[model samples]
Target: MAEHTAARPRGRPPRADREQVVHTALRLLGEVGLDALTMRRLADALGVQAGTLYGYFPTKRALLTAMAEAMMSGCQDAGENAATPREQVLALARGLRTALLAHRDGARVYAGTHAVGPNTLGFSDTLIGALRQAGVDAAAAVQTALLIVHFTTGHVLEEQAATGADPELLTEIDDLHQAIAQGEYPQLAETHKELTGTDFTQLYERGLQLLTSDVP
Candidate 1:
């Protein structure tokens, strides 16, 4: 005389998973930015009820973390097969920037979240392993990994902010450039063209060199 409970049905599944939620959230982030990124909004975009998202993320912070992790996932390829620690780190840095620049307010979204997920942690491990292989101490390797991330994220944030500036701000910048061109500022005027130009790649490479110069 025992009561039997039926097993949970494993049908075709709910047609939603953490990956789909992250994808939809990323699309929404690119469309509406981080300020307007909400579970409700994401669910609406995915054509699912808001509560269903909670089943995957449990909280808004969780979703943001997942998004950041997903963003970093593509960067793993940068360091996967690099021949040297410096190259690995450089590739990782460039890859991170590329990924961040791919979405609207991407750097802001990534910089604002702490993603300790598999993909994020994997990238960290790759960097740390490379540094360790290059003879850096364990603690310093970890710190260097963090430094690379912070530097790349900060640089991308600034780059995106500048590139996305409003016309009014841009006009102000142009006016300032003209004023500087009039030789009101000697140093800035001397390098006006270079200053006004976009050479983030060189700047980024220079920074990476500074970071990795001492490594062997």
Candidate 2:
């Protein structure tokens, strides 16, 4: 409502239409993986021409940037009242995992796409501010925060590609095991249980612990 104050303009659609297109794009990206989410498909999903979609996003890069911004919005929704810099950073990491987990190839969609958006910038400010308050130098604070963020995102992306949302990977691992001969791949054969049994929740918590602990 606030975005549509419309001081002047009768021929134009409301700003909400742009947001709707962006949201449609986000959903399409979720349903179909990023590789398949073309502008034409997004327009088809939204029942608009591909040219209309370009009014909101002139190029594939712009569409992707919007989706990345949506991911940041998701982070803001999760980052409410995060008290400390570490907590805020951790909140962002958790938020990303949550968003990517919801989509078919979510982590892949988010990977290498960290353009500054409202949510990310705010949370970043929160984390970096906390670090500065704790007497950390600016360079160290930024480097530490980015390191943790990248590690969290990279780990989740690998997990998503491996497991999907349904834990279908367990079934797939059964097939991979057949290729590992005891005599030739003893290390892998022996560690198969450990590798398969472990889940991302444990991995995330442990890595979070290590990253935070290493920060000081």
Candidate 3:
């Protein structure tokens, strides 16, 4: 009788590199938004088992940090052509906002994760350097950089939330108008048009100017 051999178990699929993983995650984030872009889903998209991803990114937070870093790549270059320190800071802030708005749920992905990667560090260093060049003290420069970043990210977060024809925002505006008409908010009645304006670009630019007006 011929000897019978047992069938061997299949091994896991080839692992994806860090770059591929991050890019794929970003694509999925755009497709399904952040909450649905789970590790299992990412693995299925990559043709690998979920456990295999842990080899490249030990935790979901690690993967998010990598994605945040990828999104921030080249943001520092925005300030390269700026002629003044204040201009450089504004350029960098604008670049960051643009980067965060590039992907769906982009601001959400970047909001809380602490990405210490080269790109993130480079962006931070460049912004702080510009602030320092503007005659800011080291401690104050770091603080100012943080304040700028916070403002940009927060604005982008609201911007993204107000996308897709934002019915909720419309309702809020309507409610504000009604309140003003009822004489409940005298100041709002006077400036309701500006308060309810949808021109986020103008709003962001104005806020940036206010923040940096004292820089020099």
Candidate 4:
């Protein structure tokens, strides 16, 4: 194998790291979303030729994976501050949500990429280790960690997607549902107020409890 390089072209600035590339990519992601992020765009943002990015991220999918993994790394100590394993697990789940929510369409970006990278692996290792310390078998520990990841990622995607909907339209739809329920579905009408008031935080906590209930 050959060593990678970041040789700048004439007039280009000197400072560049793999992390810098991801950061620039993330900035563009916030501006234009995942669909518009491309190596050429990133290169233009970073003041480098498109070929420079290939050395760091061979393909667009690879760059996406790196970005997703970078997001995961932000919550590296997900459960580190907690005293008990259960608290650690809860912390990890909550921490992941907070991290993902920090970026625009973060959950969507993360869910779509394959994060078989150091940051993602580190996150998994932390969860698995926490479970193993709590007496779970290795296989079960891995599975539990994955369960938390999958559930939280999916939940956040829906939560973010819901937030992105047109607020006025959402309100109109809610009102329409309530009006219909009042006449046609009396049972639904009775709980329509509560049903429409979806609290993602409460739902996330309950989900964490349910998912980790069997961890012991």
Q: RMSD for each model, in Å, please? A: 6.8, 8.4, 2.5, 7.7
Write down the lDDT that model 4 would get: 0.83
Superposing every Cα of model 2 onto the true structure, what RMSD results?
Answer: 8.4
Q: What's model 4's lDDT at 78?
A: 72
Provide the lowest-lDDT 10-residue window in model 3.
Answer: 164-173
Tens digits of per-residue lDDT for model 4, 1-216: 899998976775554689999999889988887677878888989888888889898988888788898888757587788989878878888988998887788987888676888778887778888888888898888888889989999988888777764568588767778686668787777777666566989988988989988876
TM-score of 2: 0.77
Clashes of 2: 0
Measured against the true structure, the TM-scores of the candidates, in listed sequence, are 0.82, 0.77, 0.89, 0.81
To one decimal, what is the Cα RMSD in angstroms of model 3 from the true structure?
Answer: 2.5
* lDDT: worst 10-residue window of model 4: 8-17
Clashing pairs in 3: none
Tens-digit lDDT track of model 3 for 1-216: 999999998975678887888989999998989889999999999988888889899999899989999999999999999999988999999999999999998888998888888889999999999999999999999998998999998999988887744578778878878888998787878898887777999999999998887799
lDDT by residue (68-102, candidate 1, tens digit) is: 88888767788777877778877887888899999
**What do the candidate models score in CA lDDT, each in turn?**
0.82, 0.71, 0.90, 0.83
Number of the top-ranking candidate, with lDDT as the measure: 3
Per-model clash counts, in order, read 0, 0, 0, 0
